[model samples]
Target: MAAPLSTRPVTMVSPFVAGGTNDLLCRLLAENMGKSLGTTFVVDNRAGANGNIGTAFVAKQPPDGQTLLMGNSATHGTNPTLYPNQPFDALKDFAPVCMVAAVPVVLAVSTELGINSVADLIAYAKKNPGKLAFGSSGIGGSGHLCGEIFKTATKLDMVHVPYKGDVPAIQEVMGGQLALAFVGVGPATVGIKSGKVKALAVASSRRASTLPDVHTVEEAGYKGVEVTQWYGLFARSGSPKDMLDRMSAAAKEALAKEEVREKMLTQSIEPTYLPADELNVFYRNEIKRFREVIQRLNIKVT
Candidate 1:
């Protein structure tokens, strides 16, 4: 049995702006976990610096489990390599509490382009050469990484445009400002359903439930181009093991609810709950994996 959690109200810090994937997941988890744990979990949006500002804030908090962070791929995975001079160390400054969800990136294009599939996109890019441009939520974001992976695998010359968020990037694609965008299915699902944008491929090994008709990149013959962005919980380093264990239990319990599962699926997130120890391994592997990919690709942010 797990020990008692802090009686104080817990705050789940979201390092990104409201209305984003992280924010949505944070609110969802906060509400569900609050009910399961019988404690208040408030979502605090502290957006800026590509998630560093808020993450740095949380890193300095006390080692008690009262304050939690909703960390995602950018803050914990690619940022370590892309922004090496951050005030907080991704690994040393915080401890993994639990992994909440995983979202597959999608290839969204403007419906005006008449492109129907990944093959069509490749052929168009080949004909246009450097004329094509793709947008992402930001540089080093999962969307950008997926675009880079796709470009490298297919040997295409599509320029990258960074946007403030996926919605804006998809808006650009809808307006034909960008040929396509590699974005999370959560934000892209609405546009795809409305005919404002079309999804050519899901950048995962398997098809996304949100867009089951869209084939995976591997299915489109671009094997090994699989990419995903995951969201998880974190607390300051050196937090008590029992506290972490109780927190993990509450999270897993909330995740086990079928209503929660359905809601998460509707948002294009897979309810992937991992305990603290397992999340530690998962987080470390992600950082290491992304580091290798960033270094080999010679990706830099200036």
Candidate 2:
């Protein structure tokens, strides 16, 4: 039998930079899980290389269940395909804990562009061709893929401008420097509510609860453009099964809290928990799906 985990405080690594949605979600979940586990769960921001640095760090750590990773779609799903020589294998290096939540990607346009809906934007792009420009957090990010999917499905020609991060990309769109952007629901919610940007359509099968008035891409006559960024918890692969189960159960209990649900909803993240067994399958599928998307779009970091 595997040895019991140490009583030391668990360290949950957030690969993305601080103040982003990933960090916020990690902290929120860690705080609640800490309470349930009777141990302090601390978030350590190890942001770099589009989350590769932190994720790889966790992969190398001993599987005592004390070192955890707060992984997102980009870290565990898209990066493997985006980076040809990834330092670590997402599927092989980690043990699934539980899925935290999924947030929809929203296509937001500058209000000054006078584009009120996805149809309007598509029509404009078709007319202007390569003149319409869209920005993303990076070349191979979920937002970037959403833009590429939009381009493919709509048969529109638009230029892609890659930014260092989503905040700058969304800001440029709001400033009318770019035609539009595919942003995560959290930032998109704030932008929409502030009237700084107008959401054309959300790239999910169903409309987001935070933005109920916005139409989905399919509802707007554009099918097969769905992209949702999901977050999950993980531990090193060699961790004890019992320890993994305990952590997964704690995660589920934390997610089940009314306050936690409200907080996630307030941040435009839909709380949907999947246990370890189901999440492992979901994680593998996400990796495969993103790999196909990257191959189809010829997306690569280097």
Best by TM-score: 2
Give per-residue CA lDDT, model 2, range 2-65, as digits (tens). 3324478889999988987788888998788777777788899999988899999999999888
Q: What is the lDDT of candidate 2?
A: 0.85
Candidate 1 off by > 4 Å? 1-4, 296-302
Flag clash pairs in model 2: none
Q: Model 1: clashing residue pairs?
A: none
Instruction: Put down candidate 1 lDDT per residue, 206-256, tens digits, no spaces.
Output: 888778899999999988787788889999998787777777888888888
lDDT (0-100) at residue 119 of candidate 2?
81
TM-score of each: 0.90, 0.91
Q: Which portions of model 2 show Cα errors greater than 4 Å?
A: 1-6
What clash count does candidate 1 reach?
0
Q: What is the C-alpha lDDT of each candidate?
A: 0.87, 0.85
